[model samples]
Target: MPIFHKISLRPEVENYLKQSFMNEEVVSASSKQEAERRFEALLIHLAHPPSFTTVRVNTHLASVEHVRGLLLNELEKQFSGSSVPVLQHPALPDVLLIPVTGPRRNIEKQQCEVIVGAQCGNAVLRGAHVYVPGIVSASKFMKAGDVISVYSDIKGKCKKGAKEFDGTKVFLGNGVSELSRKDIFNGIPDLKGIGIRMTEPIYLSPSFDNVLPSYLFLQNLPSAVVAHVLNPQPGEKILDLCAAPGGKTTHIAALMQDQGEVIALDKILNKVEKLKQNASLLGLHSIRAFCFDATKAVKLDMIDGTEGTPPFLPESFDRILLDAPCSGMGQRPNMACTWTLKEVTSYQPLQRKLLNVAVQLLKPGGVLVYSTCTVTLAENEEQVAWALKTFPCLQLQPQEPQIGGEGMVGAGLSPEQLKQLQRFDPSVVPLQDMDTDCLGDAKREDMIWLANKDCIGFFIAKFLKCKSTEEKVSRK
Candidate 1:
């Protein structure tokens, strides 16, 4: 029996995605039957978390070996006597991977049930407790300290403060309720903090709530790969165009050893504030964040914006990272998505606009990395084709530590062009719940590679400006 249902999508969205996978090019490359199988597999894998919980060590302040020791000890205390081995990536030395033991056959479900939103349920599967705000519905007579079964309202049909929900719900194991029904629903000051303390989750992954705040960043495996591919050096100016939450921004600063300037830009004030806070927490001082639209980041007529602000002069940055905003259909443990076709297809124009600005802002002989967390060819492969044709200065460059496979074949890209792009497809390999108790070296290595390919669906394309080398900084 399957532990969870495949991700639910509306009929129109499903049909649209089917066209992308079963197009003439894809069907010609592989059989139509095989293309359908991969598409189905993509839906199945998206509904579950990856087999590993990946974290990046802040090598600027603490070495990877030191953080690994502290993290292993903490996992020991949490798992209590089970040998949960922490494996370091051979290609990525600063990355650590801990296997996520999952979908346990036996879990005691409780009679009292609590319903949480789909987003929160996904978080619980990835080692997060249910916060109070995520609670959508609770049983009528539920009280504090009550043992309850948690379910995700997968279709978003559950009403808040409801006694029962009959629409689609998936089991997420059992937990202890920290707040009573009245406390959560009727508390004058809206209730906050953890509402349910997970006891026996179907997926067994350690929660990184307060585990080495400065030393470790709870990041995905492919996300860490982006910074390493950017290859930021000491004292070189870099721009993180759509930086928010500071994952790549801080990683770039850390890679530069905090010696160079990192200009981070985001349009949202609150998100910029959060990324600034994250930079401070990680002890990365090189990142300077500003709330400005990246589409307007280029200064007009050789005029620069205020110093320490955005709208910098053209060819101002040695490197640029355009982590474009997309439909976000590639996130794992996502049970349902209620997006219309218009919303799903709206990212291409915006992505192109940002790409134009990014090329303008990048210095000659500079590197630019474009990435997205969506599975659509429009946002990923098609965008690559568009960028290549639109800008003669931008040339696709190879990536280091290429863990993901070649791009999908539906975007009219040639075999050589597809090979240069990296698309982390979870559907490439069948799902396997990892158990690291008695694994040998060979087995461990295989699992690590699977963990890389079986992660969330993502896309990355690196480019180098092959313009005049008069102003090029010598790369050592």
Candidate 2:
């Protein structure tokens, strides 16, 4: 059963997405009813979390089997002897899957209620405890250790420091208050810690907070696929443009066995620091994180010498991964989005700028993978079509272990070109009500399939840069 409401988007934004679904190319291939049905399904799925939680094992530090054992032990302790099966992905060797037992409808709601912000509500759905800053309202006399029902201010209608709220809200689950209502909002200087410890969440997934952080990274399934598709080899000079928090950068270093240099660039200083910290935590020594805008990363002069920093000469990198920053419309457990149509459509220009820089920095015959966690055609398939047209030397390459659907229509891409791109659309898979009684009887392969298709919407396009004939002749 779909417990939450369909994700709320601005009127204009919703209309724009509907048009994309019912575009001429899509309607030509399928009936209008089918397209509209899929669009409606997407809206519903966006407000719910994925059916499974994906964790990427650090194979460089420990084998997948060893990590899996440790994770199972931790989950046993976390769930208090509840048997939760940990399954290894057959296609992705370094990835592990855990089923998220969801929408536990029978959990009793308490008399007292607490309301949290939408972001924190989404986190709770994904197995995170509610932090102090995310608390919007609580029962006036609520005390610590009191079991209370939690709700989310989906439409941002809840006022801070309120004793109670009667606005648009959605029930998340039940949790025990970690602090009294007075302590949480009583003019404290630093009130940053767990405010509510989820005792019986609607979704029963283990929280990975401080749990074997080095051995496993709680990443999305599609994100783990990006690094594999990049296929970074040992001793290759790779550049991660717009890499922040360094998930893929560290993954690239681990994939390369820490043999080659992986230069990670982010526009923000704090994010660059986070990138470095993640690299250190993962024990990867091949990454060098720099705070620089990827758009201005190219250097015009050949004699400019900057040791291992940005503004590098053209063709300096053997491969590149442009996990471009996007509007992030595809993130799940999102009940509402406040962005206007302009904000949603603004990423195409920025992505194009970053791609231009990425192409300039890549060496001939080198591979470049472009990806985004967005479902918009402009930021995804349209960008791919634009890149192929803009860069004469670049050609679309097939992805390995293509688990996602083909590129979406309405991008002006041909059938063959679309087949080479991968788009993970959660709407294709119908939502199945969580069968808690049959959880133990579920097949591993069936669970893996559900995890793949029920994930957040994402897009990936890989390209191989070929040397121009003039350059080839010059080399000869």
Query: What are the Cα lDDT values of the candidates?
Result: 0.89, 0.91
Cα TM-score per model: 0.96, 0.98
After superposition, the stretches of candidate 1 with alpha carbons farther than 4 Å from their true spots are 435-442, 468-476
The CA-based lDDT of model 1 is what? 0.89
Q: Which candidate gets the maximum TM-score versus the true structure?
A: 2
- RMSD to truth, every model: 2.9, 1.5
Model 1 per-residue lDDT at 247: 90
- Across 180-232, the per-residue lDDT of candidate 1 in tens digits comes to 98888998566679999998898989999988989989988888999998999
The local lDDT score (0 to 100) that residue 312 gets in candidate 1 is 83
